[model samples]
Target: MKVQVLLRTEGELAVVVGEAEGETWPEMQTVLPALLRGVADRVEAHGEVPDAAP
Candidate 1:
């Protein structure tokens, strides 16, 4: 199965859109969460520092 996920961000908010081919919706159900969580984990691992006060 092949899946493509698109993420869009506006300021501090984000939206996720996903597309899959050669896979059933139910199969995508399982794949999506794992894929998202992996992404989240990677982002967290990278860490971020807040901007300094102006």
Candidate 2:
């Protein structure tokens, strides 16, 4: 199985996109948590940093 995830920041919000391929549920189960955690970390970091004054 193959899994890919992307996280993007837009203004004060964030977007998460994920994809899974192949028929390997077991592998996905093992990797999904880590992938989700990475996205969460990025979102948290983005939240902690204030936007530049406009």
Candidate 3:
């Protein structure tokens, strides 16, 4: 499994580019989420998120 990260004006996107070894999107449904979870964790840790202000 090959994974890559990309930066865009809109936001960041997780891109996985690899040769087809059979199941694609269906498999992506599972694989992608796990990958995204890791990315989200890191983002939450390093990024400065704005807190709610009242």
Candidate 4:
């Protein structure tokens, strides 16, 4: 499976992409959420999340 996400903040833009292969559907399900969480974590670590609604 593969995932791609685009992040835009302030005046900057970035792209995050990842891919992994799973032997079964259950494994694939796990891999997908893990991949997405990793991406979200990376973005948060960079302070991409705003404190207040815009």
What is the C-alpha local distance difference test score of each model? 0.61, 0.66, 0.49, 0.64
Candidate 1 worst ten-residue window by lDDT: 45-54
| Model 3 lDDT per residue over 1-54, tens place | 444443233465644432222256676555665565655555567667477121
User: Considering lDDT, where higher is better, how would the candidates rank from best to worst?
Assistant: 2, 4, 1, 3
Give the Å error, residue 25, model 1.
1.0
Query: 1 or 3: which has the higher lDDT?
Result: 1
Model 1: per-residue Cα lDDT over 1-54, one tens digit each: 777765554665454445556557788787777677655654556566255221
How high a TM-score does candidate 3 get? 0.43
- TM-score of model number 4: 0.50
lDDT score of model 3?
0.49
Q: Residue 16's C-alpha lDDT in candidate 4?
A: 54
- Global CA lDDT computed for model 2: 0.66
**Which run of 10 residues does model 3 get worst, by summed lDDT?**
14-23
Stretches off by above 4 angstroms in model 3 are 1-3, 7-22, 51-54
Tens digits of per-residue lDDT, candidate 2, 1-54, equal 677786655665445456667677886887787787776666566566455222
- Candidate 2's C-alpha runs over 4 A off are 11-23, 48-54
Query: TM-scores for all candidates?
Result: 0.49, 0.52, 0.43, 0.50
Looking at candidate 2, the ten consecutive residues that score lowest on lDDT are 45-54
Which candidate number would show the highest TM-score if scored against the true structure? 2
